[model samples]
Target: MLLKLNPEHLLLIRTHAASTYPEECCGIILGYLANESKTVVEVIPTENAWSGETLEDNKRRRYAIAPEIMLKIQKEARDRSLHIIGIYHSHPDNPAIPSESDRIQAWQEYSYIIVSVPNGKAGELKSWHLDGDRQFQEEEIEIA
Candidate 1:
């Protein structure tokens, strides 16, 4: 599927990734459907709630979005006539590839954009979607 994200949204996602270096940052992409293409219009940034017991490893490789916050975002989007089109997260010092945890947590029909942040800087970024077999398939991202 082709996921066309707005240039502004792209910038926001990158900025969020760069700022939240070391710890993974995640958020939702809100947009509307036009024929077969999903047009991204907004980005909703959320906190990484995977707090570790010790400071050394708190959310180093994991990110969890609060259900309450998600529900609230959904409701707000509904009110604005927008829908949740996808999700985005940064992989600090890692490649822009979805991990086992990402696949396990992903739902069907939603794009998952993984941003690679190496050395606290934004690196490669890509998008993916789950196929019928529930395997991740990279989606084409059009930064327009």
Candidate 2:
């Protein structure tokens, strides 16, 4: 399905991704207008517990959305008459494609938006939805 993103939400994702370049950034995508059509109203960035360098492998990066933050996001979504439509994260080194680890960790109900920050710049952002067999299918995101 296609998703329409507001200007503010688009800016938030772009700024957040740019600010956290070279390290993974993460957040939640909140959706409103849920009757017959849905549109994204907000993108909330949360604290990344795993945002720093890894002792085992400096090249590899990790990030996780804490339970407390998740609860807060849920509350915010509810307050705004919205729902959790997706989860967003920046890929420091890789392209805007779902990695094996990402696929393994993604839930069936949530869309996954990957922002690729190659060369410490936000190169591209892409969205994916998991199918019945748990495989990713690309979705279009329109900024309006």
Candidate 3:
């Protein structure tokens, strides 16, 4: 399914992701109500544990979605009749591309939005989808 992102929402993701640079930032993907296209409504930034100042291996730096936050997001989505479309995170010094570890850990049914923050600047935003066989495919994101 194609996800349409509002410009404001895009900015929120970019800004927050960049602000937490050198460490990972995470958030929930929320959908809109009463829209014909049913695009993403908002990008909600949540508290995340920083993986320290050192650039560790991918396995070591992977961000874990806190269970309480996950439950909260799920409840919000259900209340609004929206789905938990995706999860987003930042890659402090790397490109907005998924690492092998990311590929292995991503949920096949949800979109994974990666923000690449290189040198404290918002570098790129990329989305991915896992096919039936669990192979990753890059998806296009348009900011409206």
Candidate 4:
């Protein structure tokens, strides 16, 4: 699978990552899906709700999206004739790679865009797709 996005959209993710330093920020990618591909057309930022949870749920290390939020976004996407093709989240001081928790929590067939922000500076941004084998495969990000 391939993830295509505009350069400005990438910038938006980076900005969100920077603005939410020390804690992970997350958002949605609304787009159109073609054969074997998803093109990001909009970035919808969301609040990181896990930060306020118990100590076990470290804001800097983990992220959680309320099921209702996902459902609402799905409805909104469908209403706009678009799809929630993927989700993007930041990893403060970590690599732009999926953590074990991410892999386990990820929904199959959705693109997971991870951004690395080291020392409050945005570093790398990459997208992955969970396959039938229950593994994440890095997808090509065609910035058009």
User: How well is each residue in 1-144 modelled by candidate 2, as lDDT tens digits?
Assistant: 677787677668767887887768889988864443347877789766664455643323667788888898899778867899888888886888997777887987677888888777777888898889989998877778
Question: Which rank order by TM-score, best down to worst?
Answer: 4, 1, 2, 3
Q: What shift in Å separates residue 3 of candidate 2 from its native position after superposition? A: 1.4
Candidate 2 or 4, higher TM-score?
4
| Alpha-carbon TM-score of each model against the true structure | 0.93, 0.85, 0.85, 0.94
Model 2 sits at a Cα RMSD from the real structure of 2.6
Tens digit of per-residue lDDT, candidate 1, span 1-144: 899987788789989999999889999999997776788989999999887687655676888889999999999999999999999999999999999888999998788999999999988999999999989999998888
- Segments of candidate 2 deviating more than 4 angstroms: 33-37, 51-60
Candidate 1 worst ten-residue window by lDDT: 51-60
Model 2 Cα shift for residue 85 (angstroms): 0.7
> Best candidate, lDDT-wise?
1
Residue 131 displacement (Å), model 4: 1.7
Q: For model 1, how big is the CA root-mean-square deviation?
A: 1.8
Deviation (Å) of 125 in candidate 2: 0.9
- The lDDT for every candidate, in the order shown, is 0.90, 0.78, 0.77, 0.89
- TM-score, cand. 3: 0.85
Candidate 4 TM-score versus the reference: 0.94
Which parts of model 1 are misplaced by more than 4 Å? 52-58
Model with the higher lDDT, candidate 1 or 2:
1
